[model samples]
Structure formats: C-alpha cells, structure tokens
Target: MRQALERRRAAKAAQHLPHADLADVLAPSAVPEAPVREKGRRERPEPIPSRRGVAKPFSGRAPRIPNLPAFRSSTGQVQGLYPWLYGKSLPPVGAYMGVDCLTGGAFSCHPVEWLHRGLTSNPNLLITGVPGSGKSATIKGLALRLLTYGVKTFVLGDIKNEYAKVARALGVEPVELGPGLPTRLNPLDSGPLGQHLPTDPIELRDRLAEIHRRRITLLSSLLEVRLDRKLDPTEEAALAYAIKDISGEHDGNSQLVDPTIPDVWAVLRDPHPVMVEELRADSVKELRERIRPAADALGNMVQGSLSGLFDGPTTVRLDFNAPIQTVNLERMKGRGDETVAMTLACASNWGQTAIDDPNGPVRLVIRDELWRAMRIPAMVRKLDADLRLSRSNGTIEVLSTHRLSDFEAVGAAGSEEVAIAKGLISSCDVRICLAQDTAPLAMTRDAIGLTDTECQHIASWTGQHKGRGIWKIGRSSSHVVQMMLTPIEQELTWTNERMSL
Candidate 1:
C-alpha cells in the first residue's frame, strides 16, 4: 500500500513540471535570426526550379501578361515602328513632283510611261484648284522637267501670260496674241502634218476631205463663239460648201494654197457660184439672205476688232521643232469672254495640227483655266474631241480649272454642253485636286467619284496648305503630296503674289 502511494505521488509530480518551449520541443537546434537587409538593396531571390514536364499550352483562355508602360512619340519616330501605315513610294520615273506626305519619299509622275505600264488607262491629266492654289506652278514645273526628257510642251492660251517667262527661259519665244500685239495667228493656216503627203489620187482625196472637215469645224467654232449661238444645219452646210469651193479654187497644178479667214468670209458674204447652184437659190442676194447671220458673224471676225489676228495668213508659224511653245493671251485680259473663247478655239486648233505628230516627240498640251472656253458650246465640243484624240496622237493634255462646277455651268442643266463637259472629265485617267472652297465639294466628289475618305481629305485642305494636293490615279488609288519646286521654278511660276504685294 505504501509503494502504490509513492508511484502515484511521482506521476503527479511529473505532470506538474513546466511545459517546454515550442522550439525546444520541436527543433533539433536553435533557429538563427534572419539578417536585416540594407535599405534600397533587395535580397536576391532563390532560383525556382523549372517544372519537370512541359505545361500544357493555355487552352481555355489566354494567360494574362502584364502590359509594359505606354510610350509617347512624334509621328516621325512612330513611323519607324509601323512602316505600312504610310503610302508606298511610286515607281521612280518621270518628273520629281514632290514628297509623298504619307510615305515621306520622292514622288515622280510620268503620264506616258504610266499609261504604257498599265498604271493608268489614259495619259491625260486633269488638275483643278481655286486661284492661288499652286495649280499653275505645278504645271510649269512639270513642263520644265519634261523638257529635259526631250518632250515638247505647248500652252495653247495663257490669258495671264503666266508661261511667257518660262517659255523664254526655254529659248522659245512666246507668240503673244492680243488687240495691239503685232503677232497674228491665222486659224486657217495648214499646220505641220507629221506624216508624208499621199501621192495616190484616192489617198489624196481622203486627205483633202479630212483637211476640209477640220477647217469647217474650226470656222464653225469661231462663229458660234462670236455669235454666242449654235449654227443651224443649213447654215453649216452652206459654210461647208463655201470652204470646199474656196479650197478647190486654191488647188492648182497639184500645189495646194492655204485659205485664210478672209477667203471664207468673202465666200460667205458672196456665195460661190457652185454654192449658189447647190442651194438652188434664185440669186446671190437670196443666197446671202439665207445665210446672212453666218456671213455677218464671219465679217465681224474679219473687219471687226479681231481683224489683225485671224483675217490674214499666219505671220508666225508654230515651230513644232522647239522644245516648248506658248501662246500668251495676257493682252486679251480686258477682252470679253466671248473673244477669249474664240481666240482659245482658234489657238487650240492651230496647236492641234502640231500636236497630232505621232512620229514626233511626245507632246504635253496644257490648257489652264479651261472654264473660260467651256462657256461656249463649240469650245466644249472641241475640247471633248481633243481629250479623246490625245491618246491616239501620243499627246498628254492637262486641263485645269477652279472647280468642277465650271463644267456644270457650261450650259443649262441637261444641255448638250453639260454632257460634253462631263465627257471630257470622264476621259481623264489622272486627276490632281488642290484645296478648294466648300461650295463645290459635293459636285467635285460626285463628278470625280471620290470616296468618303478622299472627300474628307480634300475638305481638310486650307490655304495654309500650299503646294499640297490629292492625286487620284486610276479608279481607287490616291495619295496626298506636297509639290516641291526648285528656286528657278518658284520664281518663274510665282503669280498673284506680286499682285497681292
């Protein structure tokens, strides 16, 4: 009983002993204190071992990767990261137009080459911009550059004489025509026929018929512009017969004599015997009465204010051999629009003969402010025909105006004049449009088939954006460019600025 009591007392004493600490109870050694790290100096992290097997690629959702900080840069610098965000450089050929605002590369354009390469369907180019928008400068620069490549440039009617200085610099004297100018250009003058004259009787006959047709066309245009009305069918027939008679009478010993406006005027005033017989008129007076209006119109051009220019034979023949030729009409500034249109018609016909030289050097014919002539129906028809024939004749014609509405204003809505104007615009394969007033944006967009993007681009152009324009080539390709001019070119092409000063 005493031993059992002693065992119980020992067990109770063991249970009452103080509990040992956790480290003493669990750890085999004393835990060391972690060393404190210095400020701003991070402790190196322990390396983590790579997973034993390849982790399956994310299947359900993309793994989130922490995005880096955003960066800001100028366009010039950002372009390096995204090259395709800009326009591609064009084929390095033709004239150096300027820098492509989008791609920041040199932009050159060659109408003929572009056509040959199938880049454009037609070689003709149409440029439109308001006054002081650098249209003239661009054309002048193009002409100068083309001259270096042995291409000939012919400015049909420069009412402002804007091209005179450039023509002089090119070593070609400009043929200035106006009311006090001694220079006279006979519209009836036979122009340079590039092809050899035919010796065969049949061929000769056909050639002569073509010549007669051209002359009649020219005369009709002149009279229509002067009279501000279209010629009647009977009147046209009479005029045609008179021209044929006069031209036949001048043909002697197989040596052709060129007929002048005076000859046509005289024939109209007093109908030829053959014309009288053909018309079946009782007398010359009756014949004259029937065509009195036509006769009077011809007389005005012969004896009236325009007498010195067209009545006589051409005092100065166009030298197609020259690299460039300019017909300056600055003196015609004060003249009525009718007179200006008539002169333009005559000059264009005269220049056509030279431009039709297929075997000669490629020619670039520029008609600035074409709206001045489009006011006349006859002029519109002539321009339309010229645009269509430009490709066949190896000529690239550049037509420019302030707005496309100029074409719509050619005549009343739905008139033939309007249709002809529209046809001319449709024939162009390349179009360069500078900044324009808001008035004609809608018409311009519709007429040129501009897309919403292109419309917005053009609309954004302001006066501050000089030398900048939208070049639309083919059906959908377009680029914004800034025209760069050489020192000499800028001086030669500078206009209105002097007047403004």
Candidate 2:
C-alpha cells in the first residue's frame, strides 16, 4: 500500500510538469527510518570501468558511458550541474512531443520524441505506413504544428469528401470534391503555370511536349468528337491547340477552358441538334477549322489540372473514394471521362513541377494513384519517378491504394524486365507496410523485392498494435524499425509552430 501511494504521487507530479525529475516529483513517505550505522563500518566504493570499450551489450543493464561533467549554480551557490539554474543538468532524454487524444493529456516519451522531432528538420518528408500505423495521425500532428508556424496547408485529394471537415477546422477551405465534378476548375487549371512555371524555353518546351504526348490520344479523341460540330474561330483555334500539342504552357493555364469545348460539346450532345445550328458540321473541311478551337480549349483545360497538383501555400486533397466512371471506349465520351483526364493531367503536371522545384519550400506533393490515367504508360512514364527524387522540390509524394502492388498493374504484356512493376516502389523514400492479415505482407514483398530481409520484417510488422508500424526510412537500407505512436489529438495533430520561422 505504501509503495503504491508513492507511485501514485509521482505519476500525478509527472502529469502536471513534463520535465520534472523523478526524485523531485515524489514526496517523502512517513516510513520508519533505518538506524544509523557506526563510523568504523564504513566501506570504500569499488572502481567502475568505462563502458565505451565494451564490445557486447550487457543484457538487462543500461550501457555505461563517461558521465557528463557536473557544474555549480553561481546564482544560489548551488552545488549542481545546472551552473545557470540553481543548477542541475537536464536529463539527456527529451520529453515526448505527443498529445494524448482521449484524455487531452500531454505525454512524455524520451527517445522516440527525439526521432519524431527529427522529421520536421527536413523540408520533404514521405510518411508511409499501413492503414492504422499512425501515418494519418502523424501527418495531422505535423499539419497542426505547421499552422502555428504559419506554414500554409494544402491537401491534394484523391479520396472524395474525406478531408473537408479537417480542412475547414484547420482554417482552409477544401477544394470541393464530389461526383459530377466540374469538367475544369479555373484556378486549378492555370494558377501554377502563371506563377512558378519554368522560364527556360528548352525546359518549358520539354515539359509541355512530355505532357502533350501523354494525353495526345485522349485530346485527339475529344477533338474528333468536337469536329462533328461547328463553332466560332476563337473556339476553332482552341480546338486545334487541344488536338495537337504545344511544348510550353505558353498560354496561361486558364486559357485551356476555351469556353469553347463545353460549348462545342453542348452542341454535339444537344437535346435537339436540329434546333442548335452550330451542331451541324456537315463537311470534313468545316469540321477541320471548327475542331481546332475545341482542341486548343481542351488543351488549356488539361494544363489547368496540372496546376492544381502543386505544393505551394495550399494542400490538395482529392477524393479517390468516389465511384470512378471509367471511360468506355465503346460508348460515347462524356463529361465524366473529361473530369478523370483532367485529374490525371493535374497530378502529372504538379508532379513534374515539384521535380523542377525539388528544393523549394513546397514540402510534399501527394497524389493517390499514378496508374489510373492510362495515358501515363503508352506515353509519360518517365516523369513519375524522375520527379520523385529531386531534392530541391522537397516533393515527397504519397499514393494511397488498397493494394500494395499498385505498380504491378502496369507493364507491357510478357515484359521480361520485372523492373517495370518494381519502379514505383523503388522510387519511394519510405515504404510503410500495414494490414490485418496477408494484404500488408503481400504489399511489402511486391513493392520492395520479396527478399529474405523484407519477409522477416513483414512477419515482425504483423505483430504490432494499431497505430504502430515498421518504418523503412530509405530504399537501399534493409534495416526497418517499428514505431509505437502515442495517442494524437486530431485537431492538434498538425501544428505549424513546430516548423522554422
């Protein structure tokens, strides 16, 4: 009973003050004191050896090392380590930087907090973990900390409506995401190109060429559909721009939505084609001029999607959770197909932009999946990983997928080089493996090679509790460490104050 009481008192003191010493936190108990010994019985202390030279670890014993020098406090003439503070040296272990969610208690964890704090030291961070391994919570904590530090937040979303409440609570409006999404969002379409676009003509041309080639087929498809209609000259030029590719985003990204493609599309999809004379493109020559403007218009729209994928002062949270309306090549193309294509263009564009701005302050650029846009393969596959490792952009990307082998879905039929499937995982700076049963194990093996080391790591990973995960900080290193997360308050999970001023 007496020992329990002492323990309770110490815990109470720890709750109120995070850095208090254990001895100081507990009060004296009213136990009978042991009788004092006689002077003659005094014993000399034995000398202890320095632990630095020790080879094998002494199991169950803390590693020994040379003690840090002691000091005295001049102010109070205190014979202690803290020469400036009545003094005593602070214990080496720093307090935990975690907040308890349920009780709203601030907890102290010594070594782990040291590592957690280390993440903020880098401009780019890639957090990968199984579903419950605290990845979401940690990012949230980082966001909350960043806000206090005045770092702007943006969530590039693939999952619909998930981040809306979180975004609103954090004082930023989430880019609205839902079904029947606007075929083109204007600010999203042109904003990035207007501001941070690369100035080098050669580089600009290359980027434009890369993007154009990837979507050329899709753009042309849209063009053929529109050539069936007749529209004004401006619209015709826009249509041409969309059908063929321009290397640079020379026109403002906003120019993509020519106010022509939709208008032309409206004519083609008109409820009464006889009533809408513009819907009548009776000859191939007439179709040729009219199609130019619609193509140019569609091209601008594609460029805009790229703009939305940036890591500027905003977070892009796209909802991928929606029922994707896959483009049916057999049926007529619709607005749904355009929206999906636009989403991919935005993802591809920002990913490339981040590559160009690798060391810039825009820390992380996350797009849920890189494979959904079919155009990426028959065309722009190189950009996906090239942009991933660019240090200057600090664009740490995240691809949220239920299957760990998202990369496997890509690759040419019967391609002997499995590297095509291995490419995405290989580029990631971090890989977090998570699952209840076999899914996570399978993902780890597929993403990284199914080597013996990863196999053992997965076996170990499966044993962890929720919110805990195996963290692989780099690809070349086989070493993986498990992390146990303390409860994190959703609202306080991400704070800007933790970032540099």
Candidate 3:
C-alpha cells in the first residue's frame, strides 16, 4: 500500500512539472527554479522615466567604483575648463586699491614694492581718462590711503583746487596763489638746503651749477609762456649768461640767498658789467638786444599781472614733514591760459626743490590736470627727467590727464613739444585708463599699445561703471577693476562739481 502511495505521489509531481531539455537538466544547479518569494514581500520596483532621461541623482559625495584608477590634471588646465575657478591675486602688501573684476579679489598696488619686485621698472604712474570718468577721485583716494602709511604727497598744480580739502583734512595748508591771495611761492625758493648749498667746496660748486641751470630753464619756460613763442638761440644763450652772473654774486654765502624775479630781471635788463666787459662791443650790443625780449617777458611776471606770486622771496614754505602739501592754483582761474601755465611752471619748480632731499620721506608727487603744465616743452622735459630720477629720490610721480591728445596738442606735429609730451608718457611704467570718448579711445589705444580686448573694455565703459578702469603694468595682460572707496574716501574725493547743478 505504501509503495503504491509513493508511486502515485511521484506520478503527480512529474505531471505537474514541465518537461526539461537534457542540457538544462545537466547544467550546474540547473537554473534553480526561482525560489518562491515570501508572501507580502516587495519585488523590485519599475524605474520611472526621469524628466532628464537616464540621469542619476547627483550626490554631494562622489560614488566609488570598483577597480577605477584616479585621474590627475594641472591647475591651469582645470581652470581653463572651469573659467570661474581661476583667481590671479597680486602681492597683498599695499593699500587696498580696488577689486579685480576678473577674479573678484582685492587689488593692492604699492609702486615702491612693484619696483622692488621688478613688476614695474619705474615708480611712475600715468592716469588717463575723459572728464567725469573719476580719474581725480581715484588719485585722491590713493593719496589719502597712502598718507595713512606715512607716504608724503606733494600736489603740484591743483588747477581746480581739487586737493585743497584733502590738504586741509591732512592737517596741512594748501599754498594758494592768485591775484589777491596772501600766499606766495618763489619758484626759486631753495627750501631747507638754501639753494642746495653743501659744505664741500666741490659739492657746493656742483650744486650751484645745477641751481643755475634750473633757474635758466625755469625762466626760459616762464618767458616763453608769457611771450607765446619759443626763445631764439641767441636769446637762450644771453639768458644763460645772465643767470650765471647773478648766481656768481650769491656764491660766497653759505646761507641760501633766495634769488627773486627782480634780481633775474635786473641781470637780464643790464648785462653784468663783468659780462659786458668780457664781450666785444658788437657782441655786447647783440647780447643786450637778444635778452631784451626775454627780460621784458620776465618783467611782465615781476611788474605786470603775474607780479605778486613769484616776484618776491617765498612767503610760504613747503613743510616737508607735513603729510601733504598742495600748490593751489584754483585762485588763478579765469586769468587766461597763459597765466595758468606760467603759475604752474613756477609752482612745479618750487615743488621740485622742496622734495630734493635724498633723506626726506618717500614722496608721492601728483600732477592733476597734468596736460596744463606738461604742454610747455621745458616743463615736460623737466618732468621727464624727474620721472627718471624718482627712484634715487624715493619719489613716485602720478600724472593724470583727460586725454592722450593733450600731449599731441602741446605743439605742432613733429615739434619738440610733441616729442616731450610723448617722452612723458613713455616714462610711466604703470598706466591706469578709465572711460574715454570714441576719438580718445582710439588714440589712447594707439598710444598705450592696448590690445583689442582692452580697447573693447574702454569703449564700452559708461555711467554705470563710473569708477571702473584698466590697469596695465609692464608687459602683463591688462586688469579690469572697479576703484573701491570707503565711505570716508568718497566723502573726501567727491568731485562731481555738477552735483549742485
């Protein structure tokens, strides 16, 4: 009966199961019939089509794959692949200048440091922009910040008295020059050195020679501006002799004898007896005649409209120890361009003397509206020399002007004035350019050697990017930046003269 039961069960099982092929039945484990799943247990769910088809969820942590090797790359290549990851920062050891729009990093620049690092060959800066482009504001901001770090500033030719408030804020007075102002600056003031007198006989001789040369150059520039013509060769020679004779009279004294305009005028009017005797009659007559025009031109400065400011001994002195000193020419406004030019020439000469000390504090000499002064060939030449010698004197010259054409406008094409103007531009190793008009933009590009990218940036600048500028130092690529100013800086540098309008 048991055997009959087993046979029945086996027959039922065989009937229920499907027939298998010999190959499947012989396979290891025989494709073990899918194990019966537990009741109420979940089966694998169907994947819903993702909106972004086939994309996996991005996790903050990267998933690891078995047997995968690591990958390596260069920072530069990676930065190229992801542009926003690049950041080029300058040395962080200077006053905060602004923000580098490219990398969004703070941009700091110290002209002295740049010189040491060889990033800039010279410590001179040229700031160019159209009017209302915030060039002045940028310089003012830089000056105020530098003062906090003990850098002295000498603002020569404050055409609009823009730095007057700044000077006062720094606890120094601006030397105001005009028709009725009490302040007077003798372009010939020797400052603390008294015409740079030295104890050594040879040194004194050299110093005297230098002073005489500068005096002649300054007088020539003044007379040229007054006469509106370049001095002839004979006129220049006669003036040189006159300056030499007058300086000889002051040679014996160790104390600085301030040479006044009247003294120089006297020598020019009547050739010194010694000078006259040294020359033949015809030569004397010719010398006197040649110097007359120059003398008369100087006479205008001493006795004419320009009399009070430069005629006498310096009534005001440059306080070298003071944090700031400004030659305020605001009062000279409406007096005609000639008057302004002469005043600027004299003021700049006086400033040069003031900062001549080798042991003096490092200076930041700012020439705002620089074109007004640099238009004069002699002045521009002196400026170029100053820029070249700035390194020795621990000085940095910052020149700001409205347009590059200002240099071209100094004289006729191919004239010395133009050459001098170009020289001044070339002396600067650091250039800060702001918004410009169409014509100026093109001219600046040519003058400053701007690339196509830089040209586009300058051309597109507008009201919305008022304080933005391009800084090109040495041969490096240009940096686009927005001048960053503190609230106090903005208040001090506010130059929107039309804001009241």
Per-model RMSD to reference: 12.6, 18.3, 11.9
How well is each residue in 1-501 modelled by candidate 2, as lDDT tens digits?
999999999989878847656765586345668999888897668555445543456633445555799865554345334432211221234333343322234432222222354522222333445444555655444444444333333454344333444555644544442333332232222323333546677876665554444333334433433343334554544333432322223344523321223333333222232222333556545554544466454445434432332212323433222211111111112335434544454444433432333233433344433444422342224434343443434344444444454455544555422345455555554454433245556656655555554566455554244344333444332223233243445443333333647
Alpha-carbon shift of residue 130 in model 3 (angstroms) = 1.5
* Model 1 segments more than 4 A misplaced: 1-87, 194-196, 226-228, 249-253
Model 3 scores worst on lDDT over the 10 consecutive residues at 57-66
Model 2: lDDT to the true structure: 0.41
Which residue pairs of candidate 3 clash? none
Candidate 1 per-residue lDDT, tens place, 1-501, comes to 999999999899888967778777687486678988789998789655343322346433334545689999987799679856855676888989999887788889899888888888899999998887889988988888987777789898899888888888878899888776678887765565514657888877777776777788889877877667788887898888776666663343365567788887888887867677887888888888989998898888788757667677778866778888988888777778877777788888877775666478889999987988886787788788888888788788999899988888888899988988988888898999888887798888888888677778778977778888888887756888899998998889988656673
Error of 1 at 142 (Å): 1.0
Candidates sorted on lDDT, descending: 1, 3, 2
- Candidate 3 differs from the real structure by a C-alpha RMSD in angstroms, to one decimal, of 11.9
What TM-score does candidate 3 reach?
Answer: 0.81
Pick by lDDT: which candidate is best? 1
- Candidate 1, backbone clash total: 0
**What is the alpha-carbon lDDT of model 1 when measured against the actual structure?**
0.81
Candidate 2 lDDT at 219 equals 40
The number of clashing residue pairs in each candidate reads 0, 72, 0
